[model samples]
Target: ESAEEVIGELRPLLKGILREDKKSIPDMNEDEKIMHGCLESKPKHIDSITRAIQMTPGKALSVLLSLELKGLVRQSDGKHFSLH
Candidate 1:
């Protein structure tokens, strides 16, 4: 088969597999909740994230630290955070 034909044939199967994988992904946890509070492409202040997630500042900071250590989040100067 030509490359295009092979890709066309595989496209549906690949999409199905991706759908299954997405379904299998577990729900967000504590760190994920905090991460979700921040914008994916923009940094947000710690206070804003905390309030957005409705978490205590201390607890949000703790979870943010965990996310940072796990390489899922990046912290900029002045307590700003965004998805890494």
Candidate 2:
């Protein structure tokens, strides 16, 4: 078969695979969403996450630690946070 024909046949299969992958991802809680949004594109400092979340830096750090425990994020060099 031509490459175009092969690609056309795979299109539906690929879409199914993508949909399954989306379904396998677990839902996030509100705190997790707050942290997730702050970590978009690049890692962030404690102060930065606090600013984005509109909470105290200490409270933001607590939320970040919880997210880390949930396997949704990580802290590096004891300063920055990012998606895992």
Candidate 3:
């Protein structure tokens, strides 16, 4: 199979791992800590969130998108995000 096919096969397993990792954490995880950090202050754009969360832009967006998918955060105007 091609690389794309391999990735497609791994997608569901990766998602399951992420979900399980989210549940199994003892304390706030990097993602949750970032979420709470945003919640403590005003709503922020992705760039600001990256700075506030102290993570790379790609990593920050990934975490924020994950949160948005989980319904923990909402984005309005497709720019800013805040806790739901």
Error of 1 at 10 (Å): 19
What is the TM-score (0 to 1) of candidate 1?
0.59
Model 1, position 7, has a per-residue lDDT of: 99
Q: Rate the local accuracy (lDDT) of all candidates.
A: 0.77, 0.79, 0.71
**Residue-wise C-alpha lDDT for candidate 3, range 1-84, written one tens digit per residue:** 999999999999999999977844335567766565675334678777777767887877777677776767677675677876
Clashing pairs in 2: none
Cα RMSD to the true fold for all candidates? 6.1, 5.3, 12.8
lDDT of candidate 3 vs native? 0.71
Off by over 4 Å in 2: 1-23
Best by TM-score: 2
Worst 10 residues of 1 by lDDT: 23-32
Top model number, lDDT: 2
Looking at model 1, residue 35 earns an lDDT score of 60
Off by over 4 Å in 1: 1-28
Decide which is better by lDDT, 1 or 3.
Answer: 1
TM-score of each: 0.59, 0.62, 0.54
